[model samples]
Target: MFMGDGMSLPTLAAARTLLGQRAGRPGEETQLSFEAFPTVGLAKTYCVNSQTADSSCSATALLCGVKSNAFTLGLTAAVPRRDCAASQVPAARLDSVAAWALAAGRDAGVVTTTRVTHASPAGIYARAAERNWETDADVLADGVDVDACPDIAHQLVHLAPGNQFKVILGGGRREFLNITSVDDEGTPGKRTDGRNLIEEWQADKARRNVTYQYAWNHEQLLQANATLPEYLLGLFESDHLRYNLETDHTTEPTLAELTEVAIRMLSRNEKGFFLFVEGGRIDHAHHDNQVHLALDETIELSAAVARALQLLDEKDSLIVVTADHTHVMAFNGYSTRGADVLGPSNMRDSAGVPFMTLSYTNGPGRRPDVDGRRPDVTLEEGFRSPRWRTHVDVPLASETHGSDDVPVFAWGVHHEMFSGLYEQSHVPHRMAYAGCFGGGPQACDAAAAPSALVMPLVMALLALLRALA
Candidate 1:
């Protein structure tokens, strides 16, 4: 499933029009790819500690079948946010659906536009007290807990049983490499412990007698063979991958391309695969109040979903597309039928001052000019230009996440069960039930298995007939 982060219904409403304008079409007639999914459900995204959800809490709820506090991942709500001590409690640690999939004899993978260890994607295998503990530097920055938790990147390479990932792709090479090593762009490393985790990862795989490959750019990843049983990793940027709007196609593959490669690598397993693909930058764009950039990110995410659908068989595969939460960006002002979503509204207030068709409820670039003065920007330049920043009601440095229910779009096997409103924690249950993995309702029944008696007899008869011939 595709996640358009901070994508409320209104954000999507504006984005649909904005996307068509970018394609040289009338704004009203366009449809974002996932709009066509047959079943749509609303998910309540509140966390136990806060009304509005953060990515860590939402990630735990959706991936681990439990709701957690704001900054924790794979832990129950009982663990206080950032309480490094409580993070080690056995009752607080929850296993992910990915772990369950592995136990069910399925391979698993994770892909994202953000760092592989970022909050939402780390839910695939990590169980930590804080999402910010992405590197050794972070652990050193704060008071020590009774038990020292390894950073997120460390967990990916050296996690416990049932956490073996077949593929892990996205950014954050700086976290893995040594502080002395320069990045692809010749930037200094972010690591403090001076460990080259990439080498460590390869060495660990070799010890297990496993075929493995690591790629740092688009071409390298494309050239790697997926037909062979191998663990593959692609880290294209020191930090997060560049946004789709400004990235070079040659050096950076789109999210769709990444999804295709990941699926192919994981699909070699006869037991099947579980892949988590995140359009992670959409949330960043919204936080920066970059309307067009956010929508573009969403467009790329939708394409990734479409590509996955083509690669998967609907009969056995279950695809879920939903957002972790939303933004407070307002899409009002009665602009005409064909008005640009990224352009200004023709209507003005009593003082006769023009405003944007889209504005956030709270964010940066929001100014209160009592003298009625405005910036020198025109519709031709649009909000995308470096000079223009969208105005908001509140003048905060970054936009706040909204508590509104996000939409869940599902297709493929057991798609019928995704209807009706539900709690976010209920998601992993539905997924487990659908895939026949974990302790789900359908996992225990003998009927869940393929006809045991009939299948063996059929195989024996076929073998006898072949011998006779």
Candidate 2:
């Protein structure tokens, strides 16, 4: 499955227009890979406690089959947010689809543009009272429950069994090393516990006699597929891989390449596999009000989905594409059919002022005048390019996520179950049923109706052959 972070319906529409316009057509007719999926459904991306949820809560609802409070991962609403003491409760914790699949003897892996222990990926395995507890430094941040609640990175290394997630690939190298040691970028480590988790993982691999390999950069990762190790861990950048627009493809690989490598490695499992790929930084770009960056991230995620489709069996393997939440960016103004989506609207306002075709409810784009009303927004002199910030209605340094329903697109096994609106928590259950995981071992049986159509003809042919004998 692929999760497009902060991908709203309007975002998809705007991006689609730009995509086709760049493809030498009137951009409105094109469809992104997710948009073209056969079965589409809407998911209500809200948590139990709030109308609009953060990644931590929404991801839990997406992966764990339960809605959790904001800033908490892998725990239900019974657990208080940011209270270190209540984090020790057993009922507070919840199991993930990853664990469910692992217990059923299938391999699982997670690939993300953000840190591996970040909110969405952490929902698959790690648990924390606060999502900010990504490192030991954060566990102690503002006197959090360092003892009762371990950091997310720590749980990834120590809490999981040896066979857990045969593959773990993403950024944040220094977060695993000791605080005393310098990171790949020469920054001090964030872990206060003296334990160098990376080295510990390596030692454990050796002691247990598992074929494991570690890659700190892209070059080493490139060599990984050739050798085909049993376990792979790649920690590429200190933070998120650069925004798609800002990425230097020479130094770091794109999200598509990472996903391709992960699929190649995990395909070795004979029992079957479950993979989670997160286009995590799309949300980050939206928060910063960078429209191009967000669109490029979505485009990259769609490419990754296409790559997986090429690698997996369409008849058996199910593919689900969805978003954890929505952003505040909105499409406005009445423009021509083929108008540049990123440029200003075709028509003018009452004051003979043209606003941007794309604007936010609240963001840095709102440059207000003396009376607090935004002035006439116009294209720069001599620049007809469609690249510029959209005007905004409210003033805020960073835009907040939108509280609304997001779309879910699916293909392969049991795609019909995704036809109607459902709570976000139903995602994992439906996927489990479609993929024949957990308690839904026979749920996918009815999906093979087409293959069953040939059975009666084959039976008749067999009886005729026996009569001839």
Candidate 1 residue 422 Cα shift, in angstroms, is 0.7
- TM-score result, candidate 1: 0.91
- Evaluate all candidate structures by whole-model CA lDDT and list the values in order: 0.81, 0.82
Candidate 1 lDDT by residue in tens digits, 135-242? 877776766541377788888877853238888889888888768888777866666777888888888988999988888888888877434348887888999999
Error of 1 at 309 (Å): 1.5
Report the poorest 10 consecutive residues by lDDT, candidate 2: 379-388
Model 2, 1-469: lDDT tens digits are 8998999988888888878888988898899876777899999988988899899999999998899889898998987788777767888888888887887788898999998889999989877778888888888875875667888887887786323788888887767877789877686677888978788777777887889898867788889868878888888887777777776777787788888888998888887878889999888877867777788788889888888888888787788999999999888788989888877888776666777787788877666663544476564543332234556678788889999998999998788889899999999989988777776544757767877889989999999999999
RMSD of model 2 against the true structure? 6.1
Worst 10 residues of 1 by lDDT: 375-384
Report RMSD (Å) for each prediction in the order shown.
6.9, 6.1
Clashes of each: 2, 1
Q: Which clashing pairs does model 2 show? A: 21-27
